[model samples]
Target: MLEMRKDLFADERDDNLNEVGKGSQRQDMPGHVTARTRFFDDHAFDGLLHLKVVRSPHAHARIRSIDIAAAARAPGVKRVLRGADVPVNKNTLLSLINFGKDDEPTLAVSKVCYKGEPVVAIIADTEAQAHAARKLVRVEYEPLKPVFDVEEALKPGAPVVNETYPGNYFEYHERFDHQKLRFGDVDAAFARADQVVEARYQMSPIEHAPTETNGTIAAPEHNDRYVVHSCAQGLFFSLGTTAKILNLESNRLHFIGGTVGGGFGGKVDSLTEPLAVLGAMLTGRPVRYVLDREEEMLTGSPRGAERIYVKDGVMRDGRIVARHIRSYFDAGAYTRLSSYAAIKCTAHIPGPYSIPNVSSDVYVAYTNRCPSTAMRGFGVTAVDFAIEVHMDRVAEAVNMDPMELRILNAYRDGDMKAHRRVAKNTALIECVQVAAEKAGWPLSDTARRQTSVASGGAGERGQIPATVIDQRGQIGRPDTRTGGPTQTLPAGTTRIALSKEPVMEGARDGRAAPTQVPRYEPAPRHEPARAQPPAYAPQPAPPAPSYQPASPPPAPPAPAPSPAHTQHGAVRFSSVFGTRRR
Candidate 1:
């Protein structure tokens, strides 16, 4: 069963000593419990008009015509805006990070590639009137076939979601459908490994389902400035990104947002605020736009669907030496935070292990659906699910304890990573120990000897809890990661082998330390003692080393090919995996 891990937040204690273990009053509880917490919708001002968007009904379609004249003349309607009305229609969420630039437009211009793409926006005297008026804006469309699968989207003849992109993939660093994290020689490591294990994982998109749905209010002020009250998770990010998209200086937009009922990275996207501010500016009056429950459920951005395939090369001891992961993140319809989500997904590949060889290709593939934004840990969360299951599978193949297998190759301080950087404050070893202890499970002496630093420490090693969810029972909550139909998928078939254990060094405290995992085997030991050469003549006679470098040795033999693998058939939407060989 999945357990609640208090140890996960051991670093979250208050500073005061008395408050350490005592139940402390939450600062926001009183206001929240009393229904006094102020959300954006709670703020009312005179002449507040409601804005409603006319969304496309077809998944993919070209607009033959958008007749907004009727909506403009509808009852209580002040104005209606379309794609052409947006001063700066194009936007790129990751331009600062030098990623694929300007893929999403503020409104559907020539075509609507997704079902919910905005066609016309109606501003009216009341929320009811705005909704009624939006219905009057008729849009004509020629429906185009859309590709939903990540792999299918990359196929040569597949329907392109965005015609400007040249393909259904986000291009990065002059390449399409790829972000690579290359470290050591994976091919060589695989050759040395005794066995290879592979598995594919898929996760469907899940809605955040926060207590408060997204809403915003924008008010116009003197000197063409605007003030926005939103529930965006990060104020600075929303302020700057929205300001840039509006073609206005950041100083012109005064953003007031300190209360978010709950947002696990869901509200980070500057989706509603930009349009809300634009409405206030165009109408020269306050505009309030709030997503009712139905709109939020159907149109709000959810976690991207993920599909991942992982292949690992390891010795008999469950010590991983090489890994190859390929992931496709379905950045549906438009690229929002999905590019960064794909980045994070790839970054978490070969999770927390110190492997010697790694190869990862993560792609954020565009498809026809609502644009995905961030969800709690987004990319990392999905990859973590894949890799952990992958690790357990590897352990089972080698007939070793899963926890012991983790401790065997768990990263230690100073361990080099797939990104070519050395790690610090490593805690995987300590993590497994604490987890086993809390579950009242006893560990072998060898397992207990492993340390995070690989050095002696007095008290418990730093907390990095490893929560295990038994495969049988249902894991509650809407989380797709920890519990879902697709997460527990098996590889179906496989072959594995293991090499003999290597010699280990003794700990400084006289205990046996965990053995080092060497990529190359040691040379044979010399058998006969060297004949006692004449005392003075022996050393001097050794020729001076050649000035030129010696030629490199012949390479080792290659490993036999393993069964081919494919990612699990599907996800609702994105996916990537990373590899690092220790």
Candidate 2:
């Protein structure tokens, strides 16, 4: 049951609404409770065949040879498929939208980039027979040194995880190796700040252990098509991918998906569909390929690990003057969806605050491990955890109340975000205030009086400095060797100085424009500088800046809507028959 906070948004509520604020029963609840729902495995087919795979034992290795003769002769073994059997051996999940190159193979070819990468597939009369035959497939490999750490992978002389991306970092916009977000000069703000706080945070990979592991059952149909019963989270997306990998027209395959035990962003990768369909094609029977418990846990994609570094410049009064973030996403052996995650993470930098000076560099680094895929919240969750914890550290550094600090710097409705988007419909301050009140936490009168709608007050909205707006097109050039920005501000350029009197940029009466902060240059990759204790004594609180509305720059074009958004009701169909293309 959900508790609707009607009191908070009372003005926007409708008096006659029926279901808006009421508790409605879920459509699937009845079937779920009674155990009457039919999952993908529930459907039975005549003469069904079971498929099992032989996986790599080494994290990185050059494949020498595969001997499937013994497996083909094993009892109940009907067919054996190798990497060469796949029509289009290589694919990247996002290639459907022309996002990334086809870097990963359906089955290991000349090399295995990560442990548990499938090398051979065996189809048999029974699941037990398939498992037995899977063991008889012999594969020879010459092991290669593997890199596991994100930073280590980016260093010079590191082992190349993927030949497609030799640099171990995804190239962004074909020019930079990392996604960048630049607003104002963070160095200038840090130079004049009373306290500088910095911290490092790391997040480990997580598995999506759904009740039903990744599985798909493919059977041939009339009209030279295949009907697939799948547990994939996205039906059409999976359909599109399977068609592309098999080099068939989209209409050549029909996908059936519904009653998924759980996905949580895991099943969207089309892990089992292509191979399962190939198995049915090889043998004239229905083939079911499902990951066993151990295989699902070890080989299935997990949420990618992340390493983040956050540095904030704060005043004694709890105002965040500037923030800088550098993060690396451990994308594992290939770019499944990590490249897009990097872009999304970069957009979320400087998190929910009105800090005037902010910059970020987010990298997607590959390592010799199981390739990572999306999970709940995808890119934003790990970084949000890091930013919130870093906020508490910032509060401790300034010796101010954590909740109060957040409220003081919370973005208002009209404030300009570090990404150049105008913040609107924000209510962080109100939410924080309510949370504090519920927790019985004490707050000063000034903190309680803060509102996200209020302007010309303590946390005033900011405008992009004229200087920053002018350099929008040429922000920074990529340093290919290190995957970071190589250039800093031009030599001998004057630094912007903050004045005692506080006034918002583009304010009334043509007042002097706000100070232009200097462009940030990241420290050397080999050695990063650590934050030191504040040397100067605390000074009096700076006067609150007065704000005035300014004409905002034209909004950027809206991003294309995600294909997942168009997904609707379950697809329905029925039949059987099957063939293989060598």
Candidate 3:
């Protein structure tokens, strides 16, 4: 059976999308079969110049002087470009969001703070020539003590990576060292009867490690116009930032890129395309700059290093009353999105589990290693690993099953979060239940009851009892362990046990059975419907879509209410199904 159809049973009803459970054809499979795919290197043109960069060998150093004379005199070398040759030298990223500390220099002018930092560009007629000439570009440097550790860098006496930060920390207006999040009385929650569990999580900076090294080809058109071929994922962002870096109007530059080898946020950085375009303009020739494996690994932006200290005050029964998390993201040498990364880290701390009180402080610290840029999961990845490990630790402290703990604290559709927003359309409890059933974990009576109560969902299925879900909407049930509640239920009187499974079931026997919930089916239509099958399945030419005369597409859903979390860079499409185009 095809993987998609593996769940098919003897008596399963059909949905409108028959393609949902069928083997589908991959559009790109033919290209791979015929071996006719083209990458950047496949394109060739006359008067093409290969560009190589001279980079810093030291982690931290002052550029005493640079002499491009020897490289300019080298055979096959056309131009040895320095910082001064570039018309505009500045960062053009996230300015609208007002990201503080714009300190990433396009080319190192007077100082190099990280190893592999670009110092000079050597353009030549051939790749080997460019490589030979780049080695000839001599640079004098005065080595400075490198601050590689975040904790040390935050110290008063530590060597600062960039002059923008006074104490190696990214500070907002009024010199705040970190962002703060507070809800409820965290101190009082800790003071009340509870067992406090704490742990620290840390990791070093990691590189993106893409298969195809960073490469870009630039060709300048007439009248300061340019057509640039780049691997940068965000087209508008790449174009806007490149225009800013070149100090040119948006219309002057056209970015072209669709297929990428791989870019998990690492390619979001506009690193070298502007310079390549500038080089092409200066020489009036198409220019290609491709970083070899060594350069890409050394200079490419990677996810920053992070350290998180999570402290949770939980009742003996597994209810977390208070959580305090302190996180530090080390953006080595430069603040490429590290400040934003810090915010994401703090936001992800404490994870998905519900808690009464939360207080967090996330800091972005600068160090003397390669600058950390956003990679896959950038800020949230490491913190999640830390939080999960901490959750298991919390389970150990409370002597309860981790899943049981999650059941008691799972956020529900009306539960107010630590952030002011009320949770909606939440399926955390259901997801946990499904996974637990599949794994065949033992489910206690309280667990079963909680699941039943929480699943009394509102909306299309008809009103089940609004009271089934309390004002909080969490799965709270009558005491199954005791005539009342479990030991986890109360310190003085009653508190929910983290080890008990959540409340549940309109009706089910004691043994756990994982059954698929019926998918929502639209109201019956009075017209004949098209038989939709696999996209690639040869079935005597599939019929056209069956839209009835004067009928309309499904009405777009109303916009969901924004949660308490600050909307930063969220792309909300108001024209979902053309509800309102503008």
Candidate 4:
């Protein structure tokens, strides 16, 4: 949204204007254009058409029957196609490279897997008509038991979503064994250890909000050629899948790309191209399909939600000896890309710390919800949040500074990760050191900072011998508060006192009160200096525009190609279609 000055002047500026003139030198004028403007204007999508699609709403069901009588009768409706209408072909875009087999359907055949799955398509003269007629097509459904929760789906007695997989475990990489860390000695370490810590953490799944939802336009032409315009991140994947579904040669597919809004890993899969191309083939006209925001959210890929449990063992010397992490992930609907996600989380269990004994396990559970897909940062963020919190607890138990404990166990560039691969770009140690210095390492007030006050008077003003309250009113040794900005509270601050007894006696409420922080006195006025804006001047007006004379068309028609050179003269097809028979 931020516009530069040159962009405003490009449209009206004359190419032959003198450099010495005031108009040419005036950069402050509202009207100016940059070179990029000319480039983009010349290359803009001048003739491309847009498409939209209608979706189903059943979470799990079977299409008992479908009647497109009204849909086909609707005005502007080009074609009403279903899974049965798919052309006979042994080809499927799926290969062994990414999938075990090509199990995806261009349109739902017998059963709809998840809610919002595309079961039928209506191509039309305009997108609005296609959408209107889409509603007119009556589809009878027999709703089945929906497995919404991962744990419920995993139960042995639960109804199976896919009979082929037996239970809803999806697929597991059973061969990949978890790494166990056995450092000094667990029994001896626990015997000599001063403390032990354990914690549980939960993380919510997130979604990738790309600006452009997945869409495509397919048009079939003569001689079996098809052109497809797509917004997918992986063109090769889409190309292969589309060709497979339509039983066309990969080389026969001509693909083009528009400026993408964003991917964030959500648009990496081949989603809607096959259906749109199929519509074009059945209708012999261009068909486009674009998903709306609600469809994008429900059908689009979302990061997986997970639960992690961590147990840690430490010694009186403030060293970590053994640890264990158990993680469970919710792999929604199809197991499309969930295995890779679980692998990533399992691999990064140890994080940046060093432990002699480490044991970890990761499980990918399947549910009837929408399939979980890739998001930014992968699954590492989920594990990191749990591990970091556990680290803090270890530091608290040993009465050691958390930052110092991290530095002692932090991994260096050459240290081996849990995968047994040596880390090459490990910056954990330096990152911690820089962040600690920037935040001011040890504050004496932390010791005196009581989490909760008792009913009686304060215990003997527990203050260290050589510490004093700083200018910001935070008690700490000199230079400890030099890391960054100090905490400052408003003047006349006072602590609020509450009763020692909980408000509700003998109540089984399962809610924890919000954590409150102690206040500090405000610091003196320190206003940062502001920078000045750049100077600008007005531009001079341009001279009267020189009108060019109109050029006349040629009187004679162009000559046609010779028969010998015309190997099946200029016949073209929409690139989205599979292929044409010459």
Candidate 5:
């Protein structure tokens, strides 16, 4: 079964035969199938009441009024719901992942924070009607000048998105010399170094092009709980989040994962599920939401953006004396997983170098772009790119072979990192040596290394191997040659850095689920006061920034006058959908 892998290793014989190591990596298991194959025959999605969300095109705005009356009158339109029709309380994706006591509303109320923020849900008997009705519903939004960049978001004068997180910095945590390892005198070592290399490398945002776009179906399941079918990476997370959003117990949610075409960390986020469930609850009927190709590309969760600056001070003998790296990740809107991403990147900033002195700092700034979360490699990839390329340049400047430089500074068995953790799989030396050998290193100086000869002798037996100038002006392989206006970028492609520090010792330790509420540490200045999740604290007062965009007063609190219309409580599946008759 798919759950067996979570338990003990039962296929040790097969793993040993395959020469693969146990733990963390073992492919042969149940519940594993190619995306194309799984649920290939399941066509139960037809005839469901489809849902459509009306989103805000502006990055930041105050909504004045949402008139869904015309949308309700549209043919095939069952219901058009604004913030008033939503659960009184707000719902957030974070609380859902953590199985928290409460959830943020699936739809925004009063103000929408970022572009593509869901504003209202339009449900109909058919998908076409829901979509058409969505276009008909009119929303009056007061546009506001947005703070798009992270640095601008951090400035004191920047427009604030949420009143809770001030200064546009969503969240912060700093570990000092006490928590971090500080070795030999870093300044003195740099001063005595023969050559020092400093370089800045930047990382751009990337997206996961999942074959299947996000979709969800919420149907009442006879009991009070709802049966939610979707292609989400974390089914438990979805279940918990949906329950919290509806203010129901965990048992009130039954989650079923369809064949996930691809998640790659994207589907881990909450996108269409909340809106679909809410729509179903509002209309007292099943609601289904499906995101098409364009919608997925334009509005799906994207990769986090990063800027990294690294400096290395090395001795004349090619000994790395010290290293320093400063990294910043654009945490769009909410902090999301960017904080954890920053830490992972920073921890690997020093890379596999066995330097005496190393110090690194990482910062995550809130931006008005898509909410950045986990990508394939997270923040580690960004820093890894910066450090490796910096090492390459340091080798060139010192007139030493790049491979030699890496091997010399690379960690050996039982070596300790700057973070005080002992390296378990210190294969840096072997990796460097193996890669150099494969690239045909240590070539004799007298050997004629030819790349390309001539077009006339291309396929002839007695043709001279093509000889061309290498990128570095050395006569070598013409295959490495480039065309006109060749410009080289600073080597900054992010690679795997230091091993990820596991969130907990082992599954048995049972401290907290990796996706559970992350223990937040306050800023250095806010020390002695641990960062607590919003679940424990009262919501902050309304935000009154210095610069106010001309906008209406925030909408009055959502109406909760109708008890039967309440989002949760006494809302059985039967109440949601009357008995279907012929």
Candidate 6:
């Protein structure tokens, strides 16, 4: 059973709704309970063949030779496939969206960047035969020095991890090696601050231990098409990737996916689909490729590790004046999705607070280990943990209550965020107040009176200062000290301002009135004198809604409310047990 706190936002909700706030039975519960639900592996085929792979043993090595003759001749073996058999061997999952360069291979060719990289695929009639044949395939390698730490990989003269990104860092916009965010001058704010706090936080890589490991079954259909039953999290994404790897038209592949035991962002890489389809194409039989427990543990993509260094300048009144963050994402061996994650991490800097001066540089660095992919909240979770912990340290340094400190600096509606977007529908202050009351924590009267809606009042928080507005107006000023563009706003632009008109309600959902047309314009460019034209032409900015007022409207008159539900016979389990004997 779940509880709903309707009293919080009763006016915003429809009381006559059927299922919005009511308990309902899950639609798939019956099938799940009765074990009638079919997973990808539950389907049966007439002539199914199993697949197992020969993995590289060295973390970093150059391949000398691969001899699959013994595996091809092994009992129950139908065929063996190597890197040469793949039509297009190299791939990067985000290449479909034109995000990154091709940096990974379905099967290893001349070099193996990480241990457990698949080098050969063996197809046999039985899984046992496939396992036996996998052992017989021989591969020789020349070991190389490997670097595992993110910082170590970036050092001068460190062993290169991926030839595709030889510098060990993903190049952003073909210029800088890291995503940067700059607001006002952080150095000036730090100089005027009463107290400064700095901390370093590191997170280790975490694996998504799904109950059902990665697996796929591909069978040839009539007319050279293939139907694949896969555990991939995204059906169309896998379909397109498989087609691209096999060098076939998009119509040549069909993917069926549903009811994964668990993915947690682990199955989106299309790891097994390409090989399984290729094996079926070569042998003209249904091929099933599944990772064993050991293989899945060793080779599966995990949440990449992140290291963050946060420095904050705070006033005696508990206002955060400036925040600077430098973070590195350890994108082991290749650029899976870590490059995109770095961009997102940069946007989330100076989290949930209105600091006038903020700057961050987030890097996605490669090292010799298994490539990582998304997990639950891949970019935001680790950094949030680091920031909140850093906040507690800041509170201690200022000798203020942690809860009170959060309320003092909580972002309000209409406040300009560090990323230059105006925040709306904020409730951080109210949430902190309710949390303090529930915890029976005492707070100062000023802290208790804080509201996220109130702005421009005497000594109020979250108001964007004049300095920030001036900085925002000068869109792309080159730093005379550093001799580089500030990288705050887009290059070659002046000032940007929101229109004063209110965009009609529900504009985002396409339910606004036809008269409420949103306005947009491209940021005018001023090209510097150069030998060649600029690499990137600026695109039109998206339509931004007009700013909301600093405060919310007055509440309407109260109507007759529904009777509150009460629990009459609720008993405390701890009381019944008379508390634990200490």
Model 5 weakest 10-residue run by lDDT: 468-477
- The CA lDDT of each predicted structure is 0.68, 0.74, 0.66, 0.54, 0.58, 0.74
Per-model TM-score on C-alpha atoms: 0.74, 0.81, 0.74, 0.62, 0.69, 0.80
Q: Write the per-residue lDDT of candidate 3 for residues 80-170, one digit (tens) a residue.
A: 8888876656452544233453566788897888999999999999999999988888899999888888878865467757765545666
Q: Which run of 10 residues does model 4 get worst, by summed lDDT?
A: 532-541
| Leading candidate by TM-score | 2
lDDT of 2 by residue, 526-559 (tens): 3323232121112111210111122222223223
Model 3 CA lDDT for position 108:
87
Angstrom error at residue 234, model 1:
1.7
RMSD of 6: 14.5
Off by over 4 Å in 2: 9-17, 456-460, 466-582
User: Which parts of model 3 are misplaced by more than 4 Å?
Assistant: 1-29, 32-35, 173-175, 222-224, 452-582
Scored by Cα lDDT, where does model 5 land?
0.58
Model 2 scores worst on lDDT over the 10 consecutive residues at: 570-579
Q: After aligning candidate 4 to the native by TM-score, how far in Å is the CA of 467 from where it should be?
A: 49
Q: Rank the candidates by lDDT, best first.
A: 2, 6, 1, 3, 5, 4
Full ranking by TM-score: 2, 6, 3, 1, 5, 4
Is candidate 3 or 6 superior in lDDT? Answer: 6
Per-residue lDDT value at 480 in model 1: 25
Could you tell which candidate, 1 or 5, scores higher by lDDT? 1
What is the C-alpha lDDT profile of model 6 across 120-202, one tens digit per residue? 99999999999999889989999988889998887656777777666677754322467666677687799999988999999
